[model samples]
Target chain A: MTIATFPPEPPPPPSWTRYLGFSTDAKVIGIQYIVTAFFFFLIGGLLAMVIRGELITPAADLVDRSVYNGIYTMHGTIMLFLFIFPVLNGLNNLLIPTMIGAPDMAFPRLNTAAFWLVPVFGTLLIASFFVPGGPATAGWWSYPPVSIQNPLGHLINGESMWILAVALSGISSIMGAVNFVTTILRMRAPGMGFFRMPVFCWTALAAQSLQLIGLPALTGGAVMLLMDLSFGTSFYRPEGGGDPVLYQHFFWFYSHPAVYVIILPVFGIFSELFPVYSRKPLFGYVYVAVASFIIVGLGLIVWVHHFFSSGVPQWMRDLFMATTMLIAVPTGVKVFAWLGTLWGGKLRLTTPMLFCIGGLVNFVFAGITGVMLATVPIDIHVSNTYFVVGHFHYVIYGAAVMGIFAAVYHWFPKFTGRMPYEGLGKLHCLLTFVGANLNFLPMHPLGLMGMPRRVSSYDPEFAFWNVIASLGAFLLGVSIIPFLLNMLSSWIRGPRATHNPWDAIGLEWLLPSPPPEDNFGEEVPTVISRPYGYGSGEPLVEHQAEIERRLQLQEAAA
Target chain B: MTSTTPLAGSAPASPEAAHGHANHNLTGFIIFLCSESVIFLAFFSGYAILRTSALDWLPPGVEGLEWRTPLVNTAVLISSSGTMVLAEQFKAREKLWLFRGFWLLTMAMGGYFLVGQAVEWSGLAFGFSSGTFGGTFYLLTGFHGLHVATGILLMAIMLVKSFIPGNYTGGEQGVQATSLFWHFVDVIWIILFLLLYVWR
Candidate 1:
């Protein structure tokens, strides 16, 4: 059979205009997603700084209460919807097809449509700040009654716009789920069975499946909320005998699993990086892979834990509490698998490795607190307090964001065809680790002291911790500079990346960095073994020697 | 797990199946329909909860919905599903004219169902803000009607594409996707019918 038909030399890189325009290429779409998401990340970070600035002292001096509400609301909405979700999707678009040795995604046009919806919904979301009511003062959870209130009586108030934007975002994500699930299931390279697939692909499948089943609840709820707010439905309007708590059920049903939808890919990132950095095969590969689906299953039922303080029935609270804690078993399986992978191996403390280790440390902490919060009593005690804030930030920022940074650093070579500056990457990781811990750790004590979250001002007793947290927030803000600089300079004039810079064992590593326009071209490499054969020297793909020879020849010709 | 047969494991994408790509598209489409159905489930659940909990479920003046038009509308919509199946079967057999006739008939039935819904909406005694029951009634039925309209639009597009001479004869995946979507809309209506009309 025909195999290893590498082009004589690499074609010139595609024009920069492709990034701005509608390009169906998965790589372009991936870059577009990443860069756009980072832009919103910066915007969200700025809003966060504003929030921390207001809370620095025990007074509401920097921004007024209404403005503070808008800032924090926008901050959460932008960060979760625009940054974390899109960035992971960008990685999926770039990696899934390449990892499976497909030419491109199964539904390339659908993928493009999904990416474009991000900016549309993002713009509409941010535009809510410009509207009369000053942008969705309700929390990111957007619980009803509060979300349904519109004193301004404007046709397109902030809450309405926010609901519309969120619903549109849900539609975009559902489309993305369809595309990713289809591509993963149907487009694997020859011999890449479900078991032989990389753990990342497994995580992606699990995450997208959650998206398919759970996201529509949120979208439907948002639409009903908008109808109540604008079109005069009583879905959540208690004045008209509507039930607000049912809205809570709908919101948390998706929003709670949404936390997993965001973090599962990060878990996959940890699973991917730990083996490569430690020079070992992933310990308990099948279990780590299977654990993701387990997490998805439990993720669905455990959403009611978010409602323990919202006055759910005691039986529901008990049932959800059990399911919530049970999720930790699968998660712990992954954690132990990573630890086992790292144990007694030649370790590389590269930038990605540092971030992975840091993220793992933070995830373990988050997982403990997650179980704590799952207990109905503890959740009731810390409900709507800064402690809950601390716990999730540990998951969202301390773990997930840090994991995302690790992925960027690890894949920078493959994305841009140039190696990221190691020193700058390390600096970014160090500052981020220090800044995140400082910013979030104080909140735990403040929460235990009964200090509530999402407030502009607090009592004088909370002042000391607030000051330290604000300073940490500013440091976290500064942490972005090194990352932007590294990505910019590396792409411009950093050392040219070899085909497999880290000697990684995946289908993506076999191709040249920033792989060709049509990935794998005519001869799609049939995966022969599992990807994490690190020191075992087991071949990953058939015709390995021929493929390597052709790769070298093409590189030399270029 | 360490090793796998290269060729046999990837048989789905092999060159053997005559409709391999079409099958993948249908798989993706069916999955989309499944996801879409959950949105309707959310609406249905909301209606059920509101209906059961409210002391006075109906509005002041109106006793309840008149089920006659909707029953006929439901029959019209359900019959379209049968026509849709015939259209797809004809396309598979390469009988282009028969496919077009049945496809057009299905679209006409879908349009008729939508018209019937609009008439029923217009005849309703209560506004959308009447109460929890009225709000849910309009929201659920209106949402379902919107889906029916979308399905008709999709079928219209496929019908237009059929005029391209050899579209269906060459095998059109879009036709199957649209039909699947049409059937999904019908299934949602069945549930909505039970909750909104028959259950009372």
Candidate 2:
């Protein structure tokens, strides 16, 4: 049998300009999602620094009250909607199809269309600031009455634009969800059954399921709010006998599960990375994969817990609290599975692994807080405080962003066809771990001390920890400079990566780094064996020969 | 788990299934409808709240409307589902002209329902902005109306594609997808009809 060939080196890589325009190719689209999402990350990071800077003292020094609201609102909105979610989507776009052994996404043009909506809405959201109302100052949640109370909600223009931006983004995400679900379900390579697929694919499927079922509720809420503000419709207007709480019910229905939409995909990244770095098959692989689906299912029901403080009747709160707390079971299965994978293995300690390990460490704490907060008593205590903020950031920034960084470090070689500088990557990882803890860890105490979040300033009594958190936030911010430098400097000058630099066994690693257009070149991969198969195998022997042949070809050419 | 043999577990579609179209278009379309139902659920929840909690189903300045015509329109919309099923069957049988005729007939029924809804709305004294009743009524029904319009437009596109020689040969996928959406809209109308007109 003829073996598939890998080119000696990536020949004359595609121009950087492919990143600039419309491309139906999934890789091209993936890059677009990543770069654009990173830009939004920077925007959100700058806003975070401004927030931390303002909170360093009691007074709202940097920006006034309304403006501070906009700043934080934009910070949260950009991070949640624009940055983290799309980055996950981008990573999925880049890797899932390749991992599944499909030529590209099920609907390539639809994928491209979904990607284009990001920029349009991201720009719309950012542009809302320059508009008369100065961006959705009502907060990302845009709790009605407060959101609809101000004509600024209508006339000031920012909240209106925010609603439009969010609604449009929901449409974009729905399109993407349809594509991802269809791709994973229908397009697996021959022999790659559902159970045999990688854990990452399973997580992607679960997240997409949440997106499919959950997002339209947000769309429904946004459409109602839009009409309420724009056409003077009363879907949320109490004077018109409308119930604002109903709107909250609709928004959180999507937004809470949406909390998972951002993280579950990253969780998959952690699952995939741990096994690769540990040189072990994902422990209890079926359990870990099923755990993700469980998270998805539990995620949908627990959204009501966000409103415990909103005067939910006793039975409703109890029901949601039970459901919310139940999520920890599946979550525990994953954490244990991760730990189990790490046990009894030759650990590589790569930068990617470091972030995953660190992220997992933080995730445990976050999960602890998650369970605590799921209780009605504890949640009501910190519901409006920075304690809640600390807990959330621990997961969102600490866990999810850490997973993103790990995925970035892990995939950077494949993406850029070059090795990132190890020293700088390690530095980046260390500073980020310290900074994430420093920035978010202290907020728990501040909130416990009655320092409500979204305040432009806090009392002087809370000043000390705020300073520490601010400094940590700055450290976190500074950590990215090294990452950007590492990627930029390496993409141009870094040594060309071998096909499987980490000796990982996955379908994607079989292809040359920075795979050619159309992904597998010509012949489609027929997947065999269990996912993450590590031992002696036909494909393994063939792949080793191909890599050696390519190395020898490069040697001969030189 | 069928981990040992790939062929048995894998989708039986060869590349000859034509440009990867058969992989999951029908399945994707169905899943999309399920999600769409959730969207309608949000509206239904709001409608249910308005129905039970609100003091009046017909708020101030919104007089009651005759239900007779809307009932007929509901029947018209539901019958379209029947035609849609026929379209799916004809396309699968490769009865091209029969499929086209039924497909157009389905589109016409959808159009008729939309117009019936429009006439009902015009006959009412309330507007979208009137009050909670008017707002929810117009919004929910309007949302459903837009979906019906979208389903018709999709079917219209299919009708055009059906006339082309190579398109329908791809199977009744186009027919199936359109029928799925068309029927889903019809199903939503039953709910909308129940809460909006019948309960009122």
Q: How close is candidate 1 to the true structure, as a TM-score?
A: 0.96
DockQ, all models = 0.36, 0.38
Q: Lowest-lDDT window of 10 residues in candidate 2 chain A?
A: A534-543
Alpha carbon lDDT at A444, candidate 1: 96
What range of 10 consecutive residues in model 1 chain A has the weakest lDDT sum? A4-13
The TM-scores, chain A only, for the candidates as listed are 0.99, 0.96
**Which digits, one per residue and each the tens of the lDDT, describe model 2 over residues A404-509?**
9999889888867799988899999999999999999999889888889889967799999999999999999999999999988998899878767888877787
lDDT (Cα, 0-100) at A103 in candidate 2: 72
lDDT of 1 by residue, B107-163 (tens): 999999999999998988898899898888888888888999999999989989988
Clashing pairs in 1: none
User: What TM-score does prediction 2 earn?
Assistant: 0.94
Which docking band does candidate 2 fall into?
acceptable
The per-candidate TM-score of the B chain, in the order shown, comes to 0.85, 0.85
The reply for model 1, stretches above 4 Å from the true place, is A3-9, B1-23, B169-171
Question: What are the fnat scores of the candidates, in the order listed?
Answer: 0.58, 0.65
**Model 2 chain B: ten consecutive residues of lowest lDDT:** B1-10
